[model samples]
Target: MTTAPTRFAPSGPLTGTVSVPGDKSISHRSLMLSALAVGESRITGLLEGEDVLATAAAMRAMGADILRGDDGVWTVHGVGVGGLMQPGQALDMGNSGTSTRLLMGLVASHAITCTFTGDASLSHRPMGRVIEPLSAMGADVSASPGGRLPLMVRGLAPAVPLEYRLPVASAQVKSAVLLAGLNIPGVTRVIEPVATRDHSERMLKGFGADISVETDADGARIISITGEAELKPQTIAVPGDPSSAAFPIVAALIVPGSDVTLTGIGMNPTRAGLIGVLRDMGGDIETLDEREVGGEPVADLRVRHSALSGIDVPPDIAPSMIDEFPVLFVAAAFAKGTTRTSGLDELRVKESDRIAVMAAGLAEIGAQVEEAEDGLTIIGTSGDMLPGSAHPIASSLDHRIAMSFAVAGLHCRDGASVDDMHPVQTSFPTFEPMLRGLAEA
Candidate 1:
């Protein structure tokens, strides 16, 4: 497929009811844990985007019988815990860091050697965080000097379980360690300074693993899992991604005279920090038709345009909305006053340096942004034209960065232009079309 560059021009109010793609995080985890389960696990509402499809393909390469039914449901006949065969070739993970890193944990304990590779963007992300922990647990992992991708992992049989304390708040690193422990002989424990998303823990328990979480006096969470539990397959229905819904939700809140209803969105508290920040910014968003879906909270979000004010975002909330900083920066650009955000070191290690990318993009578009060691502070323009001349923002092929800036352009003085929108396919392939549809509506 050829790469394409696209630009967004300033637009009017966006109005519509739309369903975003299935939760990318949950979609990836469901396929992986289900593939490690004992029987046929049926899943509906899985994201078919390139990143997730790459994960499904990786699972198949690991000997899981994964297929899509004629009715469009996905079914996985897993080889069960410890039953995965040595893959015959390198697992091409495409642009999915979630797949590559999480699968690394799973592959680390088996008696096999699997080489993992990805596209240029993924190749640049640091994999050493995962490698360090897994290596300590007896896995032989070798990577480029900077711990980048295109690495080889030699699994160890009867691997020793480990007790690790996370220096950074990352669900990916925690999930990787826990997955590796599944094939080890003893209990594996991980202590997190700040609680990251718990989808992996929840899904692991649903698949019948022996895992427990406890909160200490210092507010740290210690997760312990006993290895070698038999996993039983169950049907799964993935909730709509809150991360994906964030775009339209913010659009409705920022665009004058706009109202929208986003349905079946995951409201897992860890991922709902965006909603909290938006509400505090005085956005008129409400939750209706609330219920549970597939072990997750789901709700229909109704948002209407409202005057927004900036507020300080606590560092503690960083983990819940780590993927949302870029979009939040967009919202901050249009709000009144200044918004301060901290505890964002994790943002630097994502698909791109999100903090740096957003700072540069926001600065180019007229928002006064200051980049700090761990976060950024934005002085809003209150919907005014950017003071300086405008220029196109470089996306570096980061899908979230591209989409966030596109949304920002909607409210910019001179609509923003982004280079290389082709990377949007890695997650939300329908993003541009969906945004266009909203404009037409």
Candidate 2:
């Protein structure tokens, strides 16, 4: 695949009704859990981006028969729980950290040995987070130095069940441990000190797993799943990714006279923090048609141009909107006050160091930016607008960073350029065209 360079320039009002791709997180879990069931599971609204496609391919490699219809519905025929077969080759995870980690857990308790590899960006991400807990569950896992990818997971038949406490708030790590419990003979539990996305828990229950979640007195979540349980196939309707929606939502808010409607967005509370924060900053965001879709909360959102004010982003909301921070930073750059954020050390370890990378991008585009160990302080243009960057913003192969800067370009006087836009295909394959559709010619 070739990564082409792309640029976005200051534009007039952005007006359109659009729907982003299906939720990447849910799409991954749906494919994973569906592949473990005894029968075929049908899925609609699955994000068909490269990352999710990689998961579909990986499942097929492990003996699941997966297909996509002309209408975009996907069907998965499972090899049943504990029925995964050894792959003839290493699973190339592309740029997906979620798929690599979650599938590791799924493969851990089965009677198969799978080797995992990924693109340069993914290979650099730390997999030790999943490896540590899974090893405790008796899955013999080994990775490259620093626990990066190009790793191997040898499943433990009748894996040992164990209680593990998360050292950090990560849905991937937590979900991996829980998924590993599927083939174990006893109870498996994950104690998260701070909650992250619960797509796995919600989807697993929908798939007929014996799973339950309880909250500790301290507001932490304790998730438990019984092992050796048979999972029934489900008809899953994946919701539009809230993370993907952040792009257009922020773009409309910053671009003058813009009014855009994004429909079918997931309203999962844990994943909706960006919308709330943007609204608190005085963005004209409205939630419409609130309802449930395949067990996930979803709604359509209408956003119009509005003056924004930066505020202190509470750290507790980090887990909910972590992926949106890059774009949120772009919105802050065009706001009227100082936006300060902290308690986001996890951002340093994403596909790229989002805080540092975003700070660099903002700084390059002539915004006032201060970097911190765990946070960033961005002083906006006070609605005066940025001069935009003479140098192209280095995206570092992160799709969010690339797309976020694309939104930034919409509000800059000269627009902005990213080193490469191809990374957008990882989650939102149509990002460029979709975003361009709303821009004035």
Best by TM-score: 2
Give the per-residue lDDT digits (tens) of candidate 1, residues 1-441: 655456676577788888999999999999998999988999998988899999998889989999998888999999988988888899999989999999999999999899999998899999988999999999999897799879999999788899999988889999999999998888999999888999999899889899999999999999999998789998999999999898888777777778888899999998899999999899998999999987899999999988889999998998899998889988888889999999899888888999998898888877889999888999886755453324668897799999998887777666778877878888888898888888889
Total backbone collisions for each predicted model = 0, 0
Q: Write the per-residue lDDT of candidate 2 for residues 252-312, one digit (tens) a residue.
A: 9988889999999999998999999999999999889999998899999999999999999
Task: Compute the lDDT of residue 12 as modeled in candidate 2.
Answer: 84
Error of 1 at 300 (Å): 0.9
Model 1: lDDT equals: 0.88
Could you tell me the TM-score of candidate 1? Answer: 0.97
> Whole-model Cα lDDT per candidate?
0.88, 0.92
- Weakest 10 consecutive residues of candidate 1 by summed lDDT: 383-392
